[model samples]
Target: MVNDSLPPNQRRFFLTIILGGLSTALAVVAGWPLFRFLSPDTGGADVEIVEIPRASVDVGGAHFLTYRGRPVVVLQKSAGEFAAFSAVCTHLGCIVKWVSDPGEFLCPCHAGRFSTDGAVLGGPPPKPLEPIPVVLAGDLLRIG
Candidate 1:
């Protein structure tokens, strides 16, 4: 509360200081939850499986790894949706590179193009990329 006995300038200054302090406090309180969410968790031992963290693949990005002694790729189509494909090109068995700008997979050897869903889009590829079984479990992707 403003003191009635204070000069007008002093009263105004006090009110401004009080409001500024309260607003700063409220801002911190509101921002803490978001800050916590964005921070990385510090605990947990590494558990091995044929599993990968879902965050490892960004939107429209691909994760490449060996599955069953063959090169494989996993792509995140959208939020929480994923697809896996054999990385080998259908025409010449060459590895396919993901071209995110065009949103297609390109075979470096033959210029073969394939859609994210493994459909043949262009070039000399004989067929679509082979798909692999994938299961989404919570925060990890279990691929076979």
Candidate 2:
């Protein structure tokens, strides 16, 4: 209770300070719970699967497949395991071509060459192709 006997100016100053502190405390309390709830959950160790099939891709050959409507390349290795990577070239975003003769994925626009394992072998591309995670699920291959 404010003492009505207090001078008006002094009472106003004290009331203003108390209200400001109350508002700040209320805002912090309200904001903290929301922040904790809304923060991104990035801690899981599970792989997110994209869909693919168990068909054999020939070595020195490339097959283009779509996952989530995005283009990906399925390459067969000399060791017989299939590896999937994004078809988009790291150099200038051009689509890469599978050059069967040299057994390399080639980006025609910049002469960039990537090995069957998605390693950048030559020209312009500063990094390897982005590999999509693939796993065998029964007869189907799941990619992510």
Candidate 3:
């Protein structure tokens, strides 16, 4: 029963409100997935410990694995020392590679480098790689 008899200003105000609301709703629907994809997982309650065989990773070598849908790296620094870090680079979320000769991780995307112990060495990374909890369990490496 709406009609053109309504005042022009009232009609324009209602049209603006309706269009603005529709645009906002559409934006939220489209942007929610992108926000979730770019955001880091901050909840730790669902994370579980993962075990790897000590013999599998060689000295000065790295093993890439997935923990709770995220990439992780297990580094064998020496004969008996082991460390675990999130494989995602701090700069731009690119996966890092283990470079044994120089004993560091290299991010192919932006040339960010990290030490074997997960410290930022050179390049664009603003912070060190995230260290994961690691424990030795009778020839097995326990990581979380």
Decoy 2 TM-score against native: 0.60
By lDDT, the better pick of 1 and 3 is 3
Clashing pairs in 2: 50-143
Query: For this target, which candidate reaches the highest lDDT against the unseen true structure?
Result: 3
Candidate 3 residue lDDT tens string, 19-74: 99999999999899989999987555476988889988898899998887789999
lDDT of all predictions: 0.88, 0.81, 0.91
Q: Can you write out model 1's per-residue Cα lDDT over 1-144, one digit (the tens) per residue?
A: 457778999989999999999999999998999899988754332322368888889998999987766788999988878999999999989999998997889999989999999999999998999998888999999987
Ranking by lDDT: 3, 1, 2
Model 3, clash count?
Answer: 0
How many pairs of residues in model 1 come into backbone collision?
Answer: 0
Residue by residue across 1-144, what tens digits does model 2's lDDT show? Answer: 559789999989999999999999999999999999998765432535656556655655667876655678887665447788999999899999898886889999989999978999999999999998776667676777
lDDT of predicted model 3: 0.91
